[model samples]
Target: MGPDIRTQSLTKPVTVAEYLFTRIHQLGIRSIHGLPGDFNLIALDYIPKTGLKWVGSVNELNAAYAADGYARCLGIGALITTFGVGELSALNGVAGAYSEHVPVIHIVGCPSTVSQRNGMLLHHTLGNGDFNVFSKMSSEVAVDVARLNKPSEIADQIDHALHECWVRSRPVYIMLPTDMVTKKVEGARLADLIDLNEAPNDPEREDYVVDVVLKYLHAAKSPVILVDACAIRHRVVEEVRALVAKTKIPAFVTPMGKGAVDETSPEYGGVYAGSGSQDAVRERVESADLVLSVGALKSDFNTAGFSYHTSQLNSIDFHSTHCTVRYSEYPGVTMRGVLRKVAERVDLKKLTRVESPAVKNEVKKNYEDSKTITQAWFWPRVGEYLQEGDIVVTETGTSNFGIWETRFPSGVTGVTQVFWGSIGWSVGATQGAALAAKDLGTTKRTVLFVGDGSFQLSCQEVSTMIKHGLDVTIFLIYNEGFTIERWIHGMEAEYNDIAKWKYTEVPEVFGPSPKQVKKFIIKTKEELEKLLKDKQFNAAKGLQFVELWMEKEDAPRALKLTAEMSAKHNVRLED
Candidate 1:
């Protein structure tokens, strides 16, 4: 990072690249995630100069996933890749971010304007000299795309794109041409702050929405609070928490809304995924006369194959842009203001004091206590090991479903791509979330529970984590094959099996020093318990890898139910 740009406030001129990176740094992003290509090589130099470290990934897709985790942890994240092939490679990750409502600024380095104007054949192009095709593909997923072809319009476009990304909580595309990287931009604008706060909700409309919410809330004899993924994504956790606390109603979280509500709270109920929910949780949520849903995103995975039994007429849903009171939708009303107002105005004395059952994670003894580690016992056992402020990244398959059974400590930020359902995302995300935690000057631990099969897809990113010297704890679930798939469709299919690796040897292969990497091969319940209680193991040192061996056919109870419903939904009706 070149000599501290925050105090300089350049009044004269700076390279457009400097201005861009400086603006990014000002957002408090200490790192930029991506790989360097020839087209973007020069632009990479500006990153460190603007006081941002360059966290290069093994591949563009991993970079995108890392950026997604980073964004979820720190509010804003960015990744840079060379044009055409590089950006195209990251499309799936970008699409994942879009689906989950994450704010990731994707900066793509394109061929020179001259090459585009002359239709010159480029190496990364489609071989047809159409430089715009890749950007066109990106536009489908991006909330905004700012093309930096014109020098005069560059600053405005970048600022506008950043605004949209932050406000909408979605990915934005910025096209940086090779030639324009060195061009001058007005640097005085850097003196001004990027207005990140959402535009205030309209006074009358906000009041009306709040009033409607209170009317239904006050009248309902049995009302419950249902928090979802968008509550975290839309940056309304504080507001949601306030409402939950003020109302003192029973609070529950959806599958994707793992850490949205502090599980330790007395009001906090267990994870509610329709029929997949625990008996007590399902009964509480489905029987509620009125459900106050905050920032809800009802994807199939979140709802357990659209099995949500709560009637829309009795549900009041909230979102960043809109809120729905029963069947009547209030478009353009922001949830932030409405939630806050409702929390402030609601009568605490009127709230029904329903006793919320404590959702605790205790090692189960469903089967007679045995040496072998079973899925039933392992999930809750791992949950007992979790600490407050842990960034938990669960992979798409079994790990995702198993997490529902594991209650969390307060302040844990969950990183799950259920809607996207991208395999191997947790590997890169663990790196990013740990990096983000470090960037924020917090002692928060980045804990990952990933499957062996999912780990193989982007395992190279672990090398990047060790290279950066991030202190991370990985609980690599060493099942022999795709256990979740076997539970769903194929019990004995060869396609479900993955090649086994010497998992304990991973630290030596990816990490630099034997002393820095701590590895454990845990095959039994007693061994896991012993390790979990060890003083040194609990310290959260650098690159601690613990492999828990489990039978391939076993899975969490929630997954067994979900996989069955999913299998039924997948059958093509004879039409």
Candidate 2:
């Protein structure tokens, strides 16, 4: 009957949502983290049908965070939200992902074609149009923009945005018009696109920079390696470790660059973040005959805004975009090629450090004595929980603080948004990381220790965790406010305090079941231990919440030191 009555379909027609989902699938993104808004309804309709999960987020910012987190763990994050307000809330997460060099795909729904023509005040319109905010954010973070102007551009744009994010390791925005989502498109397959161009890595400039760096390394009696965040993101940990071992030079990591070289290595001089920085490290850096800074940004925060009060002199900066042989002179080269060349020509055998037992003891003493504050208080225990293959994705406030106090756990990975300092990043990142862990067949648990304020931003993504049956546990430190901002600005309580929630109830509120997904709220150390011992609570649940009811004054010592550093440097804190 069907053969006689109906002709064979000439071609497969696809909706904009189907095209987008297919492209996202090709990008290897299996889930979409977002809250369905009025404008984004069509994309939501296609989620379940297209085999991609529509993971719910309580807030747009958190959805972005979750997407970012997922991207960090899973290779790329995809977020869907309405225009204007939704995108605005998610910007913090996208910005964080951008700074941290995580590739996140933001699929924001714009007003329909009719609304665009009218130019009237519309829902989710921020005066200058919905595109203005996202475009500005993308530009600021070195992100690529792919607008789906015509319905046909959906697949091509999504594919392009995803590819760009992988190439640059930054977030990219793909704006979807509401009208376009339900419209039909022809031959919209992202997998069919070809990337014909090669990324530029200037060889001549790299050689010149490498040659200059080798000259100093060959001549210097004491050569120190200063590592930063870029080195970590570049997956140069093995190279850094090899260099540290070959040189036998004391390696010092910038605050953002902690874990580049293992902390247990004989060469590690501890992290260089002003107050927490070892005096021995400060002195060694000051006295070094040659200083090789790899992937260092040398911003005010790392240098205490060039305060150099603790240490000074003899630094040759080798960074991502540029280099410096002298304090004032600029040299040309890309960081990776230059470092790769350094790994090739340096006197790998002769570099050795004079044993300094006293200095080592002093560094250990400093680490032990750091626990007088709330942040440091948790590190030693948290350090114990960390294992090989574990990945730590931290929120803005705690990211730096954790790095400052905690030495990189051997074999554990750390992810953060130190460059952008975006808040509400931790929880979002947790979901993505969990997905990554599962996909990679790693036994290591994905732990997210976000500040209470940050957790509230994307805490709703717990449902995604539940849906996937991921082994993700969140340690929500309920300090009840924006602790970082408070410390940085010394703001009044009104500016800092966040809304109170039954913190442990997050998993229950978002998860599939209250019994399967356990939530524990604690104020004291004893309660934490009791929950820690409860196997049923932590095991095999879709999600689990361990909330630590902390005091507003209980900021990490390193965070406090950051505030102190900000004040000393006279850097204006944003309200």
Candidate 3:
């Protein structure tokens, strides 16, 4: 007879690395993004064994950026890096995820437990012998931090961190020491699936809040629904959309909430960014007697430097974990659940339908098909070219502002780092988004709009994109420098200038063959128009890169106004 079955079942053992990666795999993480470091080498070895693909990134920062992108597309993402140096390098990217509410598990490999107890100075350390410094720093950005020193607590710690990540939709940190990578742990815990479902809310509190919200809705003569970025981050886009659809109310998206709802909807109004908003949007939103703002983040950029005229007395705000109607606030009343309740309880017949401005008003400015490209000519045309199911990523400068003028089709996804305002984030983010889209078997193309200055910050990730055979289309805005910065503070300063590279030749230099990639340099309206209509280009096969040249001083109207506001705030007032 073989070995006794009962004995094997009682004490089956597996490495800690196996346990962690297996747990991550169960959470639907098909690929891990990071760079190789000395401390993480052993842990990296267990990646393939656990049925996960290691996406070797160009750098730790890019790895984090890619992980954020992947998380937005795949629900949750994971990244691995070594201690101090590696973790610090990726902090900004992780911070961006934290700010925007993306769920990413940041696993950092540290020195062995023995070294930590003995206080040995390691290479990645600050020579202070204390390894808790980085964890403390990470605590500020991550929702939870888990330091796995004992093998017995590893499973519980991992499960807890992951649970927080999913429930909160925020990043979490896990420090796994080198010695603990191979430690034997009970294998039976793997049999239990991690619980990611949101906990039950108090029924009495939820019902009370819903009743108050309906009272306001019933009293208002003119009301509107405003969708923002948090709706997408909190996984409540469908709820917000349902609320708008059932009520047939005029809905407008904030700058950060661009693609959260279908722009093609009949009830959709344009973007609302305070003074920078479209004439109709500004008039309608500010004039409304009541406003239902869902998952709204009133950051400087999103609100056009706090220029909104809406009064708090008439506003009802819905957040991830709470709801506030005018001055009264209700904690633990989740936006997702509240939206569902509102949708179910709302009386459509009692609600008034207001007429919004005609969509044709957006096309009032006519282009003469000029040879030289202008911001006025570029944005509207690009808007016309956007297709359904395209994932659009914009950098922090001109791209972000100009994209606001473009309307996305149904099923399109928009990705930007507005609140964090990190430059050069779109390059790495596009790579991860493309990979995620591919993994989901979606034919959607990854389209990125980045300024030349921002592209230079994280351009090396293009190599990773080519290596994975991802279908991505890059529209590199070549204006010779940081156009947005110039508009903000320094119009002619040398600090805003950047080296101009042969942007069209980047794909060829980055290791993709001519046949594998398509390149274009567009300087005129005719050229852009021709390229947009090309069947092969629209197909977005392999890697497609277009270098779009424009005047250095040209910028979107919204960006110019917002930059002026920012410049005013930056100045010191001598009272």
Predicted structure with the largest lDDT when compared to the true one: 3
What does candidate 2's lDDT look like per residue over 1-575, in tens digits? 34511112315567778877777776677878888888888778998777787778667877777787677666677888887778887777777777667777888888777777677687666675444555566567647787676754555666677777776667888878788887776542443753623254578766776777777677777777888877765545677777777667778888778667777676777766545465766677656777777776566566544545422245667654567775544444556566666776777664545532122222233343332324555665566445566677777785457556565556667766676766666666677778767766667777777888877666666766787778877778877788888887765668778899887766666537555565667777556656766676445345667777766776766677667777755765677
Local error of candidate 3 at residue 127 (angstroms): 0.8
Give the TM-score comparing model 2 with the true structure, all chains together. Answer: 0.80
Candidate 1 vs 3: which has more lDDT: 3
Candidate 3 has which clashing residue pairs, if any? none
Residues 318-362, candidate 1: write the lDDT tens digits. 999898999999889989999999999998777665767679885
Per-residue error (Å), model 2, residue 433: 2.4
**Model 3 Cα lDDT, one tens digit per residue, 1-575:** 89745335547688889989999999988899998899899999999999999999999999999999999888899999999999999999999999999999999999999999999977989898888999999999999999999877887898899999999999999999999998877778899989888875688888888999998997788899999988999889999999988988889999899998788888888889999988888999999999999999999888887789999999999998899999999988888888899999988777777865444324338475458888866777777788998999999979888887887888889998889988999999999999999877889989999999999999999989998999999999999999989999889999999997998787777778777788899888888889999999999999998999999999988999899998887895978
Give the residue spans of candidate 1 off by over 4 A: 1-11, 365-367, 572-575
Q: Would you give me the overall lDDT of model 1?
A: 0.88
RMSD of each: 3.4, 5.5, 2.6
- List, in order, the clash count of every candidate structure: 0, 6, 0
